[model samples]
Target: MKRLLFALTIILALNVALAANVDLDQLDIAKFSLTTDEEKTINFEETEYIITTDSITPSEIKLFFSPNNLVITAKKEKPIEIDLNNDREVDFSLTYLTNLDAVTTIELKKTDLPEDEMDDESSPISDLNPKDQVNDILASIKANLKFLVYAVIVLIVLIIIVKSYKKRANPERLYSKAEALHKEAQEFHKDGDEETAQELYDKAEELREKARDMENSEV
Candidate 1:
């Protein structure tokens, strides 16, 4: 009976000691630039992390990291605390910062605080230093700004959808859509994507012709 108990204790200790810590040391490059539609993945210590550029926006880089099957969306200059082992303690932190040029920087740091001490340290907001407070404020502001931008985009899309469903055809509406298409085509042309640019240009010309027909019919 004594021998069995001792062996059980050792097994439990080993299991606790072998709990996984997501590693980032396998990343060969510290910083890299990714264009839209480009992605990079790295595997380390049985965990995989992936980062990619935003497909819709060429200037933004979006990152997806999975540690212990927990997906994380990274934001610029934000440090995300992760609990890798699911012990309700922070194991490490990862910060992703991106530039306007689509260059990204990754930072990984291991937390030194013990599991129990972490709870005590986090219980008080007054413990944070001045710099941390400022960072928190800035992050809050950025989050609000992001939400507002998304809301505006959604509103614009809703307006366009509603206007399209209406029975009356407005020449001004068609002209505005043609103008928007022309702007998009110009961007694609500037990027040297001639095929996409030409497609958009053709669509803009079609819209312009429809607008002219509507105007002549009304007159």
Candidate 2:
């Protein structure tokens, strides 16, 4: 069981590593504009997002997701950094579009930095479109495989317990049969029937082995 758990951990780690190596080209680049009092919602197979620009402070952007919410204040020229999966990588960016001191309009876009410019410790978050659908399918299959592994382990353990219980139930009966075979072999040997005596001895040994196994069986 310990070995099984170790193997499972290794497989999980490998899967995570592979998933982290996402292709930037496969991701859909998002670009949109939001004015004061404007709201937009985007839905994907795996995740959903609802965003709005504050009416009073247009630079303040609000993103809605399940169980959590994120709000950011954008600045002119400097893009607002977003790390949705908390991997320290920038997945989305927001920036103010006006030169005036008062905020008015904001633009939402994908991270524009080159892959080489990103931090070495960074990993991209799962965004929308074909990539999101693919991720959802892979996650579903991984969960199913985990369930199957646990089921098979349970079945094997149950079979072992049942077999051990059967062997332990009537060990005395096996020993009695083995003693009878041993006495019969001795009688044949005393009658000068060497070949028959040898065969009988072999049968006696087999019965004795069954008795020993039954006695040693653990449930």
Candidate 3:
């Protein structure tokens, strides 16, 4: 009875695995647009898409969007609504076949400015009032000041951590000490002091080993 139950479980798992394999060519984007245009831009609150597949059920379909602001799922022929959280235009959408190495991409249309208005070559600064321009400059400086302060703080913290790590395990210092000891050993050997030369060579070897260990630990 136990063997029979195990066989049934394996069959069930295989069936589920087979159901998740979807073909990219079999999937189609039937429709993709905003449900309503409250203004000139596409409405994020009512963005809709209609996806279809030749064999895969809607439950098996998965949807992904970038810059990853929206969380939505695909439904059968029915339209799926998405909230983009802001009025900014969507860049693109991606559809993934779950457990299958298949993907589909859809590029969204960007909001367009009137051609006549965009062709104007006059500088925008010319239209701004002197007082308004000063206020805008001040606001920009204020915003950047906060970011600059945070960046400096982060840099200081990183420098402190790096200095602390080097103090604990300095491979360059170990290597330099090893090289000095090796030179001293060579000089002692040249002077025919065999015992002192051997001792210095042993100390150099130990320092070289410490340097190698420090380098390996970092990796």
The candidate that wins on lDDT is 1
lDDT per residue as tens, model 2, 121-161: 22233333586678745654453454456556755665676
Off by over 4 Å in 1: 1-36, 53-62, 66-69, 84-87, 113-219
Candidate 2 Cα outliers beyond 4 Å, as residue runs = 1-28, 43-45, 55-67, 99-105, 112-219
Give model 2's clash tally: 0
* Cα lDDT tens digits for candidate 1, 100-148: 6644555555466455434543232355679766765554444345445
Where model 3 places Cα greater than 4 Å from the true spot, the runs are 1-122, 129-131, 171-207, 210-219
Full candidate order by TM-score, most accurate first: 2, 1, 3
For each of the candidates, the C-alpha root-mean-square deviation to the true structure, in angstroms, is: 23.6, 17.7, 19.5
- The local distance difference test score of each candidate is 0.56, 0.54, 0.47
| Clashing pairs for predicted structure model 1, backbone only | none
Ranking of models by lDDT? 1, 2, 3
- Give the better candidate number (1 or 3) by lDDT: 1
Pull out the clashing pairs in model 2: none
